[model samples]
Target: MARQGRKPKGRPVSGWVILDKPKGMGSTEAVAKIKWLYFAQKAGHAGTLDPLASGMLPIALGDATKTVPYVMDGRKVYRFTVRWGAETTTDDTEGPVTRASDERPAREAVEALLADYTGEIEQVPPQFSAIKIEGERAYDLARAGETVEIASRLVQVHRLDIVDVPDGETTVFEAECGKGTYVRSIARDMGRDLGCFGHIVDLRRIAVGAFDEEDLVTLDELEDAAQEGREPLDEAAIAAGAKARVTDFRPLDDYILDPATALCDLYEVTLSDDQAGRVRSGNPVLLRGRDAPAFCDEAFATGQGRLVAIGSIEEGSFHPKRVFGGRH
Candidate 1:
């Protein structure tokens, strides 16, 4: 008898997919769906979104996964609705009602409250949150009928605007904030300040750093494309003039983005081929050009607009801190 080998796993798919997550689907679940749809070998998400919230969920596959941290540190914009007169344990409608008030702040009063929230402010996250307390999730503790204490931290809110007064019980708001700012905490604090308890009735993330709502792709679109066999995986190999191999997955080149896109916030530095080689070998390369970006803490090094490495500037030299593999 001949020896048998192990079956192959997933394909080496790489890129980013901005998903328009629907309500009731957790971020992890959305990632799993996308990963399976693409049959990718490696995948991850930039940020965590609760099941009750829906919006842009940036899924990073393959090499793009290395840049997930940059996307996570970027700014975020959220549109949410606050239901006045009642508060919930989870800070959203999913949890049981914890308190109620007859008073509802008027539109003028809500507008006045906006200024206080803008800029840096201290906020304590909700008890029903993923924040860890003694190695266990705070939500887990709360679910087990245990008290959880979350310390307050400073978070920045760049902009907060009241979009509309939906009804006597609800107020819609759009907020642009830095990383770590929680929309639920904003609603909870605003209600307390206005002498009314409140909870988030709805929440949607519209933007994350450079990625806006416009770039979102729905799950149905991906599934339908998979079913129709729009572009087979072997097409990718054929296009590259390589040997064709059999596979049952759609081509993801159109959906995936170059890893360089994630480093848009950093300045650019072009290096010679020799420098690029040095960078790829995990060594720092000298940078010199008439248009060199002013010395900064970090910059993206490239060879003819193709990413070579992400490095730092120290003492008139560019240090290749994290070099990328393969051509862009």
Candidate 2:
């Protein structure tokens, strides 16, 4: 019997592409599009963005996929609009209106209810959701006309603010919340409390973890930059000095973020070349730096400004869990 390392076909491009997904595009479709554009061997997205929602979708290619969970669990910011007087089955404009109301909430009423939604709260997800139920997707059952009782979950909403009362029928809101917080649920529940049924007319995710809306690369921008297809990358090129790392990836356009960009929230340990070499080889190393933590549940290590590995630190020693190959 023989064992060998797995080698990826195609260019082993790796990095985070913070896509500003346009409305009506699905998260999976966006990920696939990026993968095709970069010709990456592996790719995945951190969070799910609905087909109708638009904004920051952090897509990880190759080694960056390892950091997906950390970014997905991080805080998110959304700017959404809710239309009063009708609640839909899906809690958004795409679904049929299930409840209608002649009543509309006042600006003061909406603002007062903001505090009620803030902090830890119980939220019922929309009927049309990806959540699983008895081995089936909730949305599939919903679309097939089968009614299922969806359980409510505890989610944290750090802050909610009424950005504008655009009209008597619509209100724009901005929310900063922890993972699993649904903007649609907020609209539905707030409407019930205000005595006016509501549904989301527009939803946009402005940020996820370390990525901000300002860091977004639009779909149009990406396609425009790729008029000339990407150049072949040696997998290890990202760590091969600054100039090659910049010019070798693609055109002069700044489309990709560092693979470690999604790891900003993690505890970081800067390592020496020798230690990095050991870490890259799947070995543990003592955290000899003066600022090293005695213990940490999760942390990432970097050497010579290149990502080395992500692991946990126990008793002043860093254990390599998912090690990055080919330098960066």
The segments of candidate 2 whose C-alpha lies over 4 angstroms from its true place after superposition are: 1-7, 228-249, 326-328
lDDT of 1 by residue, 199-311 (tens): 99999999987798778888887766666654344766778887423244544446666677778899877788888888889887665766664477988887866777788
Model 1 misplacement above 4 A? 1-8, 230-251, 272-274, 326-328
> What local lDDT score does residue 13 receive in model 2, on the 0 to 100 scale?
68
RMSD of each: 5.9, 6.5
**CA lDDT for candidate 2:** 0.87
lDDT of each model, Cα atoms only?
A: 0.84, 0.87
Clashes of 1: 0
Candidate whose lDDT is highest: 2
lDDT by residue (tens digit), candidate 2, 137-191: 9999999999989899999999999888878999999999999888999999999
How many clashes in each candidate? 0, 0
